[model samples]
Target: MSEGRPRLNTEMVRLGGLIKQAEQALITAKTIALKQFDLTVPQYAALFVLGTTPEASAAQLARACLVTPQTMATVITNLEAKGLVDRSTSPMHRRLRETRLTDTAIPVLEGADRAAVQIEEALAVEFSPEELRSLQELLNRTITALHQLG
Candidate 1:
């Protein structure tokens, strides 16, 4: 509020920093949670996607993760070596292979979910429920708009 000075919203700048901190915190939590299962961040992402879309192809997963199909192939290869995922002919398309979470992966996914919940809870002390929900919705809209631009 100074004369001849540009105005800036302090809240926006603080929120940006919060977003970066949140990303780092979540990644750290994921690393710790997945250590016992020997999964990397990308491997966990692939498993989470496969668990949600049990018949997704590696190509689709690559798109979701914003990585090359070749990169996804390597991630899948690692997951397969760990027995966390299984690949087979898609029931919808015989020529296309579908990837899915294996039975063992279900428990791992559950543990990841629990870890995420714990992270959120630990961060919850900083924000009210309504504020958290509003932040979540805002981020979802931002992501949706970004994807729509592409």
Candidate 2:
């Protein structure tokens, strides 16, 4: 090894891989759980966001969901076609469109949310309250550190 070179941390590398694996597993679980509601993970993500931020534009939803604008546009179109969301010209900006959940979507979103909570609940049961809090903090810190790198 070069004298000036730093040693690689195998434990940190393993942790990063585990994080990715866990994320993929969570997405898979969500996909199966949401299937009964005829929604995909991305669709559920959009609805989840819209549930809290009613009348958000596709751009806003895209940002919040961490997806590209084109991807979000497709999601909005699909949701609109399914009658799960309504898009209208923004009152504040006539040229810009905003989207909100329809009455039909409220019940579906509620059901999907319950399904998601079940997955979370199952995971939460494996950890003590204090441990869960610490885990959340660590994950948040990890995310912050990654963002700083970029």
TM-score of each: 0.71, 0.89
TM-score of 1: 0.71
In order, what is each prediction's RMSD in angstroms? 5.1, 2.8
**Model 2 off-target regions past 4 Å?**
1-12
Global lDDT scores for all candidate models: 0.82, 0.94
How many Å off is the CA of 99 in candidate 2? Answer: 0.5
Q: Mind giving the per-residue lDDT tens digits that candidate 1 earns over 70-92?
A: 99999999988888888899777
Give per-residue CA lDDT, model 2, range 7-32, as digits (tens).
98766658778899999999999899
Give the Å shift of residue 18 in candidate 2: 1.6
Instruction: Assess the local accuracy of residue 105 in candidate 2 as a C-alpha lDDT between 0 and 100.
Output: 98
Q: Candidate 1, overall lDDT?
A: 0.82
Top of the candidates by TM-score: 2
